[model samples]
Target: MTEIFVKSLPLKDVISNLAEAFDTVYFNRCQEYQINIPEKYGTGFIRGINFDNGFGLLEYSCSFKESLSIHFSVNNIHPLKFIYCSEGTVKHRFEETNKLQTIDQFQNVIVASTSKNGHILLFPRNQKIQLNSLEISRKDFKKKIDCDLNHVNVNLRKLFRDLNARSLFFYHGNYSIGMSNCIDSLKVNGLDGFTRRLFLEGKSNEILSIQIEDFEDDQKEEPKRRILRKADMIQIQKAASLLKQELHAPLTIKDLAKKVGTNPTKLQEGFRFTFGLTVNNYLNKIRLDYARDQLMLGELNISEISGNIGISNKSYFSRLFKAAYNINPKDFSKKIKRNSSQQH
Candidate 1:
């Protein structure tokens, strides 16, 4: 098993004086990648920014060793990128692109790029990139902008190209500041996944509605809008119900969506809007709540409780339980038992 180290810092508090912080968190539990933190200066400086709902924005910069290669796997569906650069430079080569391009210092702008090839090369001499990884689903994004996915992609690409074509635009010759400000607003005003789904869906529909009004003014055909009807709401409710019922099963978004007769994307949006939780978060809450109930019953050991909750790996279960409850499962059970005995 390989382990990857993760370090996160809050930037809103530390960005004034250009201060830097560094540390390494152990990752022996992850079986995927063995991440090595070289004894390099100023490699893991991160500042955290809170977004709307439970989402978080992280800004960080790293300087890699000459010819040093780091390898890791990524969940392909989620969108990821390094959108802004304060200083220094780095070249990224993806399996999809043969050429390596240097992303230089661009103040107050967001750069949107994808990493399908899973390889990024950081130049040695103090390379810095202010990255904002928006953990938004493709479906939700479409709803927010009230455009089809393909059209949205085309428009976004055009936006990026327009920004790049100009040496200087608005304040910083880059559109990153505008995008970042917009994201900040979304993070501050948007609801949690559950609430955001409804908000985004409504917003998207509203955009299409406005577009329709414009078309009417121009005497053109109205554009078709992808609105979530009553059936869609019912399907989302059904999926949430099923997920709640099968708390101990390996519930996947795909499986839940299929069972409810909807696609994964819509299922995700609907679940978030209807339940105020992502599918995985909702399921985990179910499992954790069940585990708590079992602990209170005093009939099951920690291992048994974990197993019954469908967390087959005892150690992983313990860690997860601790992360959620702020105590190890065994200790939590003991505390419950002690309290029960005292009450009697």
Candidate 2:
């Protein structure tokens, strides 16, 4: 790891300073100034673009080779930063406050200028480090939008009205798996050049939108239907675990509920609320994922594997398998067999 000192005396300096300091930065068009840094602080990549609208997009997946501490004296004026960590944890403390706030795995932080001038962000080594951050220049962002940004989050509305204030406003919450998946897809895409610029811009906007939705969802006064008490939900979740471990057992909804010391209604509702799937559908997904592994192993026919996962009707199982993965189980099995034969 590098022992480093970085001071974005004003928030706007962070990006420009980084581009000039690191040689690993690469981008589509030299005109776009869109750069990707592969070995900043350690082994990982930071890819982003400096859009024409005076905003920037950034995604980070860096594992510090050793402990790295950042002392940032950031006096950000009108720039707003939205950061989400899908894998590791980041710790920070503002210059004015002793209270340390941590953005942990699957959590996010959205900060805009409020009444503070400086803050500190610390990244721990060997942590699962994955982050998506957006730095939007207030004046430029306003020029790009004609309507109020109220649809995203109420805090955004507050920030818009009080642009002159010099404070720090932030929101912290759990990020949806859907949001994590979206960022992961961006990390793995093969697109490049001008087309990559288009993709990056679209994804940057989407990530911002998703983070705003996270805050709005947090403020929901009305809870979703089928919500279960936390304690009882834990028991029901344990039952789900049991069902997964005993997939070959022909456990009905009623049986599973009884085994887990809850009613069928609670069982079904807890599964839906916790995992966003009905009990049966959740079971099917688990089974199908397992079946795919078996298909790749080339050890059993579709019928045998289907029976192993508690699906008996072979034809119906094939339908479910195809529906789940968009490939017939038989075809998937054959593909694996062919690949294996070639390997031998």
| TM-score of each model, paired residue for residue | 0.36, 0.62
lDDT, candidate 2, 1-344, per-residue tens: 34334443232345445545555444445333433444544676555566766667666667765666554454545456777787778876665677778998767777664553555567787765888777776666776654756555656677655556555676776665457767777777788777877777788778777666656656764233222443455677687798779877658888888778767776887788778998999999899988998888777777788888987898998899899889898888888889889999
lDDT of the candidates, in the order given: 0.47, 0.68
What is the TM-score (0 to 1) of candidate 1?
0.36
Which TM-score value belongs to model 2?
0.62
| C-alpha lDDT of residue 112 in model 2 | 61
Once model 2 is optimally superposed onto the true structure by TM-score, how far is the C-alpha of residue 169 displaced, in angstroms?
Answer: 1.3
Instruction: Name the runs in model 1 displaced over 4 angstroms.
Output: 1-230
- What local lDDT score does residue 157 receive in model 1, on the 0 to 100 scale? 36
